[model samples]
Target: MSFSSILGYFLGGYFALVISLFMLSSVVPVAGFAARTLSAYISIVICATYGVLASIFLRIVGREQIAQWTTARAFKYVMAITIGITFEVDDPKRHLDTVRPAVFIGNHQSELDVLMLGCIFPKYCSVTAKKALKYVPFLGWFMALSGTIFIDRKNSKDARQAMAGAAKEIQTRKQSVYIFPEGTRSYAKDPGLLPFKKGAFHLAVQAGVPIVPVVAANYSHVLYIKDYIFRSGKIPVKVLDPIPTTGLKPEDVDELTRSTRELMLKEIVALTQKVQNRPIAIPATSGDGVVHASGADATLS
Candidate 1:
């Protein structure tokens, strides 16, 4: 690593320690949360200012480096550092080659999935998110600048159009798209897996690409979606083999989604068993095609 790279890593590590210390303190949880949020807001401003300036600098100082694949790799690490510190992540490794430009499907158990994955996969990819993320001051602006695709989930027609737009962007532009098939996070320990949302599979079919199933193990063990029982433990990110949809039809979207969900569930169960060092029963999926606490099987008809 160059001097600049070393500096970036040190800064990134310090930032993570400071941020985690500020937020996880019991003396002032509210203050800590507010501080973290404020820091995120500030970081967005700093990153925007510096990132744009860096791009411009690259344009001026060394056009070759800016255009070089090496610089892009550096930027990915920088972004990954920012994400790791911000989310208090531990031992993040990309188990798959994200260079091929494919759709990523993962189990959603917390709000940190996007931030965590965005940091890990720093390629020119897009995420299918709700319209709300597009309105946030800093996050919204940054995501837009990063070419994220926003979908209006409230209106079915708008959602379809958004999905179509995303598909076109992926197929034509070769941009990877990340989507949480669960459509939401689960709070239960044995939440298993949520029903796969058809949108992700549809995108894969429309784009004629494979879907990379990513299993974020033990995310809930750290900081759950609905609680503050923060545990200092390693969250493993396992990027499984990509499920090909080369010869799939739009009508096969449901099957594709279900198959991916089942595969991810199996992976998560395996990981949790190893990490927690005990055998635990995973909840069965619901009738709506999502994993539920009641263990009801949800079939997509």
Candidate 2:
């Protein structure tokens, strides 16, 4: 470890401890809605501070060391500790040890999804983020340094080109890429999934890589819905079997997309049921009762 990284770790730990103390103090007198609200604000500031410090440390250490320090060290300790989030990875041996590059698709719940991925994904993985996230201060700077693929989702042509480039990256660099196939967070009251986007499937097929589905259990119970305060709890992430794309053509993308979606939907429903300790019902209609951008018959090509 470099001198800068060691210093960064120490400073990050100190700041996290201070913030955690403050958050704990907020709930000492009375654990009410007001205390939760105050803790939520403190948590946001803590995350921002960590982001800035991590960015500066990355810059000091230079590009070659960013991935190593940020993923393996900084993110794992600082973010997970401050937020009080613990991950329960199902079948880590089978899913996490794959040597070949693959496409990792996960359901999005909140901004925490990014941090969770950073903490748990394989060493050589990068994420596909929206182009606008590039403007988000320290977090944006860190992501750019880490080689995140930013796509302009508003423009179809640009989005397609971005996916093409991402596919090439997977094929040439042999690095796994994380993508939220739902395109956005499913923040609805219900757990119904958003329609799956085809770009990720296209990339997996084009690169002839396996599609690994990951389901992040809902956080509405532990995370305050009104104010976004995160309480200490286990966030279960179930990694499903990898779907192979070998010998698949462009026309097979739709079938591949549909099958993957079904698998994820089933896993998500089962996971949520486990969390709730009962059978959770899935509404027949789509998420938010409206067709998502991908629509009913959207296909990859």
Candidate 3:
């Protein structure tokens, strides 16, 4: 069958499933959570599937560097419609465009964090992921194919090597990398932060690049897995000003990470006071088609 035919079938099947769950949710409230969760996960599968193909096509064409960017652009719309959430990016300073060869760090929440990535992911960027994720089906396949930097958290030597590779990418290729310094998902109901891992800071300082913090308001109000509370809502995200690491040393990594986390915590607390169902404010994108302030700039990268 042709590509359009395949797409039609997929869309039809997905909507049929989502609609069925919505109807069920009206009677059984937990079904709402199920609908949202399934829709989100399935949407991820869709993006992964597309990423796999996009990566293949780009690799064949020798332009695979933008595979994540291509997939991330498609990811925003696909996941947005399925999950029934809107991402409002606030980047008044256009940091998302001008900055390159930087390390982006963000607060890790639940799975919905991917949606945040979709909203603001820019061109020519790759993500850093845990090594384990390289084992998942389509998602992992796409990440590995699309040039994601995977780190083995359990092995310090391996993790350092991964960071070393990332630092080289930043310096040599001028590539930007996104990382979650929280190291794991918070899954918290309130806007707060866990202590940050210093790898991201180390990478930035080592590479002589700036550190950009992407903060998403606490979204547990939209997706709380423990309580099974998943509903359609808007998430507000802010891309703060970049913190320069041009003259930093290894010893500076600790203070840099600490001070950066403090800054992001303040922003998350402020932005987390989001008002749901408010007017949707579309973030401005530059002529390069890069959205300002996407954290995960997200592979939820």
Supply every candidate's count of residue pairs whose N, Cα or C atoms clash at under 3 angstroms. 6, 0, 4
In model 1, where is the ten-residue run with the lowest total lDDT? Answer: 292-301
Encode model 1's per-residue lDDT on 1-301: one tens digit a residue.
7999997997787577657756566675554544444444445555456654444555466432222222334433444444333233233345344446788767777655544554445345556555668889866654555556655444344223446656776777666767777767776566387666577776678778888887766555555535544433456667777788998986676667677777788888887787667787666766647332211112110
Ranked by TM-score, the better of candidates 1 and 2 is 2
TM-score of each candidate structure, all chains considered together: 0.66, 0.72, 0.81
Q: Per the 3 Å backbone cut-off, how many clashing residue pairs does candidate 2 have?
A: 0
What TM-score does structure 1 among the candidates reach?
Answer: 0.66
| TM-score pick, better of 2 and 3 | 3
Model 3: number of clashes? Answer: 4
- Which candidate wins on lDDT? 3
- Is candidate 1 or 3 superior in lDDT? 3
Report each candidate's C-alpha RMSD, comma-separated, in the order given.
8.6, 6.5, 8.6
Clash pairs of candidate 2? Answer: none
| lDDT-superior candidate, 1 or 2 | 2
Model 2 misplacement above 4 A: 1-69, 130-141, 150-160, 227-229, 285-301
Worst 10 residues of 2 by lDDT: 288-297
User: Of the pair 1 and 3, which is ahead by TM-score?
Assistant: 3
**Residue-level lDDT tens digits of model 2 in 29-121:** 224333444444455565556655665666567642235335544544554565566667786666766646888888887666655665567
